[model samples]
Target: MAPVVHGFDWPDRFVVGTIGDPGERTFYLQAKAGREVVSVALEKQQSAQLAAGIDHILDELRAQDGNPYHVPADMPEELRDDEPLDGPVLEQFRVGTMTLGWDPSTSQIVIEAMPITTIDDEDEDGLDEEPEPDELLVVRIPVGSARAFALRTREVVAAGRPLCPLCGSPMSPDRPHECRLPDDQP
Candidate 1:
């Protein structure tokens, strides 16, 4: 199937938010222009990666002059219109491969998200047909807005359950975290 592309040249609002409680939360990366909104579901690692990439790029750009970034304007250069998690919630599908890059001509951060596929056995049905390509969600956001998005994304992704001191895995919500230690250890 052809990609269901949601391309936004300059979105009015874009953010990453989560629904549900701390232990059973669902994270969503949403971009909106007027009333049109495109939502994509992604793994927590994806969220962390995206944020880190944006931050790394920003740092690289600033390190050229070895000074903190500062822009002067009557109004803020970046769009501070952060959409709350509970505001205008929309349906989102799981994402598979996600790509992030910069467009020099437009000076926009490009993010592409492809749909995730489920693993299944087709031998039972005796059909050997290959699966169709998944659709993608493409978002082109300005550098300023991209920075804001990165900040918010880091917050949301880190808001999950705390990690275990010994194991490094997220602590179980219901039971005490059991460290994955060696068999010889007590």
Candidate 2:
């Protein structure tokens, strides 16, 4: 299929949000430009990783410029928790590859989400294989928006199952997680 590119050079809003209860949440990367909106489904990890990439890039930029970088206090507090995915939506492809970058020249946050691949690692010729052509969603938003995305993603991720104090694994909300505490830790 032809790649469905939503290359928003500077979208009004590009953010990651989720739907569903805590344990069953579904993540989405939505890009809105005026009235044109494109929403794609992705794993929660993908959203978290993209936000981390944005944070890392912003940190480097601030360090180099010796300027304080911050997410606007007015940024959305919640990621529209449990909002139904925007759709009449004929299609909802799973995301396989997610790329994030900060365009130094434009100072804009760039995000790319490629559809989940079904290709096998080895080819008939025993060479590495790549996924066939597929739709790619690309979005670019301001630095402040990007910063807010990261901060809010972190917060949302933390709101899920609590972590085990000993092993740091996620503890079931209704039950305790079996922790392999270190010998030193009583």
Candidate 3:
């Protein structure tokens, strides 16, 4: 199936689809120009081989345009080889969410970026340049480990919850809770 386009403003594109069974799992991304879509689907044991292939393609794209994070001078001797580099290091610099989709026609996985907000703090020294209010600086990472990426993303989101663990009740963020769980304890 063709990807569903989620609505986004100018300079941003929406990518939506599924990695395996479309009904079982769906992913989405809001990407801007020049951002890399790292296919993390390959991180799954069942998808590892495909991930390697996707990584190879992404590496070629990065080599042609020059990856923002990897300066030729900074590359380690071992990573300078033809094989694609691993995914963990790349995850550190990502700016927003990433989703994975598989194209059955080509058997290739599509990785896309999601929109994110940015806050810029004024520099006390006044030497640092300040970004415009509407401007967003984003980094794109192409991940070969989709399962790992998804799990990590979920964990981060879940950590922010104001919810009762025992009863699965929604807790008020503004009010104190009496539950014994550390997250609920007040």
Q: Please, what are the lDDT tens digits per residue for candidate 2 over residues 1-186? A: 677676787776666666777777777777778878787887777777877788887777666644544434344544333343456433346778888776766777788888887756555663465656468888877777777767767776777777677787777776656778789876
Write candidate 3's Cα lDDT for 60-80 as tens digits: 444755564232322233322
- For model 3, which pairs clash? 30-113, 38-142, 38-143, 40-145, 40-146, 41-146, 43-145
The candidate, 2 or 3, that scores higher on lDDT is 2
**Higher-TM-score candidate of 2 and 3:** 2
What's the lDDT for all of these models?
0.74, 0.70, 0.34
State in Å the error of residue 49, model 2.
1.7
For model 1, residues 1-186, the per-residue Cα lDDT tens digits are 576678877887778888887778877888888878888777788889998887776666556564434311112434554457546676667878788887767767788887776546745553565344356788888667777788788878888999887667888678867778767767
Q: List the RMSD of every prediction in angstroms.
A: 5.0, 3.9, 18.2
Candidate 2 lDDT for residue 96? 83
TM-score of each: 0.76, 0.77, 0.26
Please list the residue runs of candidate 1 whose C-alpha ends up more than 4 Å from where it truly belongs after superposition: 64-82, 86-88, 118-134, 180-186
Best-matching candidate per lDDT: 1
- How many residue-pair clashes does candidate 2 contain? 0
Per TM-score, what order, best first? 2, 1, 3
lDDT of 1 at 99: 82
Question: Which scores higher on lDDT, 1 or 3?
Answer: 1
